[model samples]
Target: MNNINTRNLDLNLLVVFVTLWETQNVTRASERLALSQSAVSHALRRLRDRLSDELFVNGRGGLLPTPRAIELIGPVREALAQLDGALKGAAPFAPQYEQRKFRIAAGDIIEFLILPRLVAQIAHEAPNVIVEVLPYPQRNDISSLLENGEIDLIIGAPGPTSASLRQTPIISVPLLTLIWQKEGLTQERLPLNLYLERPHVMIEMHQRGENVIDDALRAQGLARRSGVLVQNFMAMPVIAEQTGYICNLPAQIAHVFAQTFNLSCHTPPLDFPAPELHAYWHNRFDTDQGLAWLLQKIRQSASGP
Candidate 1:
């Protein structure tokens, strides 16, 4: 990196390099930058001469970034975004008149717990805004998605490790029991023996790993029998409704399902600290007023009536 001198380097060429890396097609890069194909080629040439590296190479699908180009992308993107933000200045975010889209990566249970009120608030306030709620992805992962700006924000437990990332706790969740009313579950709370005796429906968000409750129970030298293992949160309550098996879940979500399935909600026998939900965003976007405003709305929705 120190080998290249910035004094002779044109920032426009870096822009072109980044665009070509993103679009992976010279023609599309030219279209996005509003430059002639030959001009874009000239910029690429300037980039190669300035950096003395073939930053990109043609592949079967499109242009593939070279190893050096891959190494340079994160810093380059951050520099460009910083420059853009500075030039735009700190304009106050006006939600009522703002027209923007936001993407949130969260799981089904969170969607059930948070989205309806959020959507309603946005509709009434930021009427021109659009919201896209994506199911928590398993393959590509949220860290890469948030870093690359594919996602605007995330609502889930901690995992991202990038230094440019920031997170804040958004929800305090207590564990509760969802049981069929006919199961003769205690109105106040289920006894520990009853909790262990009944077959339990366990939720495994990733379709792997032990049930989250298992860890807490294991520490106390106790464990419950999982009559079923399910992937999605919705299925857990439904199975409990039909099979008379008890399912333990966050209180917010359990009550909603109980209302829907004509089931009963009760306190779980064991005491566990509340699990938390967090909102994560890139540090680069900390200065984005529009995003800041949307984040406030999400926070209000999570903690609202």
Candidate 2:
């Protein structure tokens, strides 16, 4: 990095390099930048010369970023965003009229718990604002997604692990076992033996790792039988309603299912962890007025009526 001359480099060329990396096609990148194809090509040439590397290579799909360009992308985008925000000056953010979209990454359960309230609040306060809730990427990829501006925030379990990321706990949700009430098991607590014997509907959120309650049971030399496995929490209610399968889920979600479906929530006989649902974002947005305001709204929504 020290080999490159900062003083001699054209920042606009960096913008072109970043745009080309994003679009992967010279014509499309030129269109995005409102520049001629020849001009975009010239910018790429100057960027390559300045960096002493082939920043991109033409691939079958489009243009593929070289390893060096991939390394530079996060920092380059952050720099551009910071500069753009700074140029807006000391003017306060006016979400009521500031038309913009925010992209948030979250799991199915968190989406259920938060979005309806958040959207309602935004509609009343910032009618023009759009909220894009994307499925949470794998834990390892979250920080880069936030840094590169691919996602504005992440709401789920703690996985960022990086010191640079920021997380605030929204709520601590207790774990509960959900079973169809038609089974006539009106017990307030599920006995450990019955829990082990019942067929389970597993909610597989992570690519790998034991379910939280399963991990706890395993620690106590116990295990549950999984008759069905599904990716999202939304699948549990339908299957649990249709079959005799039991599922362990967050207490709040279980309560909602209990009210709507033929299901009942029971305390797990074994000790389980009460995991805190947290809102995560890149530290870069810590002071961004819009993001800060949105974060506050998320906290309020999580607290509930």
Q: Model 2, 85-182: lDDT tens per residue?
A: 88876478897887989998887877777788999999999999999988878877888999888999888875536988998888777888888887
Candidate 2 structure lDDT: 0.84
TM-scores of the candidates are 0.68, 0.69
Identify the runs in model 2 with alpha carbons over 4 angstroms from their true place: 1-88, 207-210
For each candidate, the alpha-carbon lDDT, in order, equals 0.82, 0.84
Clashing pairs in 2: none
Worst 10-residue lDDT window for candidate 2 reads 203-212
The alpha-carbon deviation from the true structure for residue 292 of candidate 1, after best TM-score superposition, in angstroms, is: 1.1
Error of model 1, residue 189, in angstroms: 1.5
Candidate 1, residues 32-138: lDDT per residue as tens digits? Answer: 99999999999999888777789998899989889989999999999999999989896688889888889988877677778888999999998999999887766
lDDT of model 2, residue 259: 68
